[model samples]
Target chain A: MKRNPAALFFVAAVVAAMLFVGFHSARRAGSGNSDSLDVTGKPAPDFTLDSLDGKKIQLSSYKGQAVLLNFWATWCGPCKIEMPWFVDLQKEYGPQGLQIVGVAMDDASKDEIAKFVKEMGVNYTILLGKEAVGQEYGGVNVLPTTFFIDRDGKIVAREFGLQSRSLFVDNIKKSLSQGRAVQAQK
Target chain B: MQLMPRSKSQLAGVLLLFAASALAQSPGKKSPSVTLAPIDPVSVTRGKGAEVSLHFRVAAGFHINSNTPKSEFLIPTALKMDAPTDVALTKTSYPAGKDMTFPFAPDEPLNVYTGDFTISMMVRPLHTVQPGKYAVHGDLKYQACDNAACYPPKHLPVEFEVKVLKNATPAGRNPAQSPHAHR
Candidate 1:
């Protein structure tokens, strides 16, 4: 066998770099609250947050229905793109036990958020978000992070950033199909 | 020599591996970011004002709202300076924001700044201020977005050094002694 020390050394260096990258990627994917974090098929973390109308709203209260928990901010432009779609979808799917809840993750005042919601004509429930609550779901580092929860309260899927309206419809359908059908409470 | 082709092939293999590694590691493209350029040292005579311009650059494929956005709901990019007692930022002039339509709101034009932009500020040191170098610090608050998504508002720390020169002639200079100069 011909001894090629340079070639062997180069191959070893490349392999080491590849291993390092793989390890780094795995660590990143396990920690962040965005696309890297995989919370699918896991129980949705429940929390109590203040609704827009000075009332305490709890996530677990809406049981036996498919839930779309959206983390959005008033300053998020892409989030605005999805707002009307959400309103329409809520009207279309409300009878089918689908509930869309928007968690306003912003530093804006409650009144400001409510005003924006009113201007957008949002029909869904909006809850003021806290950093601790965001931490529970890994960390809402990105705007418009959405979780699709089934009737069993398991997160069917998680989407980060603005996605197409059709994609949202598909996830909603999947979520509604798995959860038990129960009459929605006002 | 027979080994020349072999050496070239080996080099090509290494280059390909490095290029592939870079491609896999580049994820910042998805994130929006803005950066401030290092400010040039500004020298102002005590009791006089000097114009200092701050240059900021936005990452490719991103834009930040101007000081006056069309919508009140939007967070405008603004600079807030905290200067020493001796120093004051009297005025900050923002460049007029260009009206641009994005895929998100195509019908409604929004005022925004993209790529390189500058914010000019007037820096003045009181006449009583000692002639020396002072660091003026501030923060730039901006909300950035791309064609598809928007990021939360971020504050970038900004700083610049101002050299205050003596407003009057040095006392060391012997005044031309006119016999009745004071009279």
Candidate 2:
């Protein structure tokens, strides 16, 4: 039996179309993975705001130290739950050059936030952030977006929701170790 | 393009392939569903304060954090009240929400709402108040997500009517009186 050239052409066309579709979808998936907020090896965004107290806190001011910048609001539930862990993290790492900064995105008055902060016994620096500033850093599209910045100001990791204490610690350790390795190389 | 017709089997084969692809990308495929609950109406006596709660119901496997959301990318719920100048608006407190992590996106975790949540606000009357049904509107913006993907920011408008009594003291206080005043 003789082979039909037209049938062979049709088969080849179908094969090529399927391969193209598969390749395109895979490429899209890969790009999405890399586009999360500058999680690793990028300079953290700098911000300055007054704490619940009258004092001022600046992200860049904490040079030579690792900083955990946590964006939250008084009305967020998970934020309240994470407050104690944040305080604990500060106590455990403050001496080791770790700064934990809390930025509040509340629509309520500052006094209301202060009351909540006082009730929670939050000792870290708390700053007030507007929606514009929140959008500048990405914005509180969701609650409890946490960024881990290293001593060199590079954002090492980021968590968009309520993050576990262990996950936070592990990421910080990894970033610190990486920093040391880079220093040794230098 | 050809006047020559193919066999019935060939047409069926082509139709079958198209059907398979359609099934793969069909809307009925496993997707997380989200729904919002209406805000309840609250009433207060004259010259007094009335507290009412805003409700949100999230589907399973999806959750949103309370007001103090962690990331700028995360959706933070908000309440906007439309009231007369005579009505005082107090701050609302959100109950603590669950800490939710998108399992597939192991790197980024957002504190979000998964199930039902509420926001309670204290509405007060001014010294000189009128009697009527005042509407309190709340725009709760939130980003919902399941284990794999996050939905776009949802603006849920929750409104309730509260009756103000005669000779009632306005319950809403001046936002300037608080430290976290947004105005």
Candidate 3:
């Protein structure tokens, strides 16, 4: 039996290359879901729930508009801090096809949340979210889990904590600009 | 039976490779050594003027958030006090926190605490108290994670002793020691 040094080098190179490709491809494939829910570059999971105004709203109904869906509770300090920014966003971009939705996660009765909403003067479309919706949006383990959806109804970005206005704006402007292109194509 | 020559070194090499990979994927390999300070068990004096204070010293770059966690999924730090039937415990308070985020995943960030944060428990002296060493125990529940992965929450049990004097100096806490004293 003869051992060839060149053959050993070639085999080693091939093995290293395979390992790199396998590791990176697996990592990329794993990014579509966060905490076992579809939240990135996928059609968001649709749910029908009662809006604060007593109207039944299904996520699939807002297919042509960019949606900023936020999960928050009144008692959460971080959520309270970001509520004003969301209200401002609704006023500024409501006409631009940007819809900001707040899904209250508090266990308090609707009357309690309505009182707080009135005190805070929140102007966006707020609704109540059950534990099921939290599971659908990747187990929103934190208050103020907000998702940015493109006009075509695909979630593009998500923020897990208090929303930063600048960061939120950047994501919104990018999505809106891209949405215009998407609309022009249709 | 014919004995064929086999390379013992090759078999040993294969075994070593398997062992190395298994160790790399073990659960305990990702955490640093966390040491909890000793729980000093003591009893308070039985008198109308008895008071107690519990103290904790978190290691650098480690902190536990207030009872109301800054975000969901993150465990909030807690303080539980056990004393005689006559003693009264004061409500606890936590200092403010700087907004910060941790990497729950490569692309997702979770709000959490960083750096040194402190929690304190105060017990007021009822006019009538028993003269004994009052023992109190509690844990600092926190999960330490950097910009990368988060380790499981660790409950660091911490305790302290408080002595009651006939005319205690109001137990004025050290400015450098108390959580409120820091700011």
Candidate 4:
């Protein structure tokens, strides 16, 4: 088959242009969707908000322990599904310096949030999330946005939406392995 | 130079492929949306009540809670309208929700609406209302969710026109009384 040189060159150029467009479009989409993942291996944002018990809870206070900071809302059903897993993980890893923290990002009343937490039998800390706090950690576009922070307060890994329990366990183990643990206060 | 028919056809095919590729990558990045269908102009006689139906479409791959969600935590879809003083919004009827379970919670069934749904409301005009076209503006508040995740509550603006006829509709008209019955 005799292929015209001009036609062949034109087709190749067109293909190259299309590939460039696709690549750049994908990169932009990736950055927007992976805002939380971009913070991996970086210091987790520290925030202080009132817990269900009315006491101010500071993120940096748990610096000595590995932290699993989760941003969730009352309306998020997926968040509800992961609650039991988080509860079980807390019990399994608490003695090993793993501290899980939940931040409620809904506009519900404090009492209502407290009630939900109690009903879930969540053993870890539950804090009322504020817009300012959420903005510090990529604006939390998805519910159940979880970040695994090492004992040194740096985020080792993060997950969006609902993921397998095994993934959570893996991140927890990785978080616990890194960073030095500080002595507990008397 | 004018392109041959074969070259032109080839170019068109290439453009179509590009469009398809662009659309394929947008769903993940684009936010979910619920759009209101354009409503036809409605005519109602003064002093008479009229039923208005509003049609809404949820984006594909997403569902919104029904007017009555099973859980208190879920934000149910609701319509709030500010009818003109002369015209009152009497009643709102919501469609029954579909009981479907999502992968996130297989055991618990949620009351949700997907695809196209209609919300009907009653608009009653007072007897004193003058004949004119009135714009009824409102908003439909809903929280959307997909199989994997849920989005926060959003309010989509709702608007429709109601033309009130100048002639008043007679109320409580009894069928003509028979004169023979009186005898």
Error of 4 at B131 (Å): 2.1
Whole-model alpha-carbon lDDT for candidate 2: 0.65
- For B1-183, candidate 3 gives per-residue lDDT tens digits of 121123335434544564444432332222322354454443443343323334444434333454566444445656555644656666566555545443323233334445444455556556565445554555566544423223334676655655443443236746577455657
Q: Is the docking of candidate 4 incorrect, acceptable, medium or high quality?
A: acceptable
The CA lDDT of each predicted structure is: 0.83, 0.65, 0.60, 0.83
Model 4 alpha-carbon miss at residue A68, Å: 0.6
Winner by TM-score between candidate 4 and candidate 3: 4
Q: Residue A143 deviation, candidate 3, in Å?
A: 4.2
Model 3 per-residue lDDT tens digits across residues A131-184: 898888777655557789888778888875554589898877766655554768
lDDT, residue B39, model 2: 52
> Where is model 3 more than 4 Å wrong at Cα?
A1-38, A53-56, A75-82, A107-112, A162-167, A173-185, B1-38, B44-52, B57-183
lDDT of 1 by residue, B1-183 (tens): 577578669767876876566444443224567899989889988887889999999887789999999888889999999998888898899999999998878888889999999999989999999999999998999998777667778999999999999955456655667334577
Kindly list the interface RMSD, in angstroms, of each predicted candidate in the order they appear.
Answer: 6.4, 8.7, 9.2, 5.0
Taking the candidates one at a time, how many backbone clashes does each contain? 1, 61, 15, 0
Model 2, runs deviating above 4 Å: A1-36, A178-186, B1-154, B157-183
Candidate 2 C-alpha lDDT tens digits along A1-186: 344577657755765675565455444432112123343467777767777677777778986778888887765545666799889988988887788888887766788888888888998888987676566565445556777887778878777656567988987675555555347556
Residue-level lDDT tens digits of model 2 in B63-118: 65567777543447666667666777787788776665555444556665667777
Which residue pairs come into collision in candidate 1? A151-A179
lDDT, residue A48, model 4: 87
Top-DockQ structure, candidate number: 4
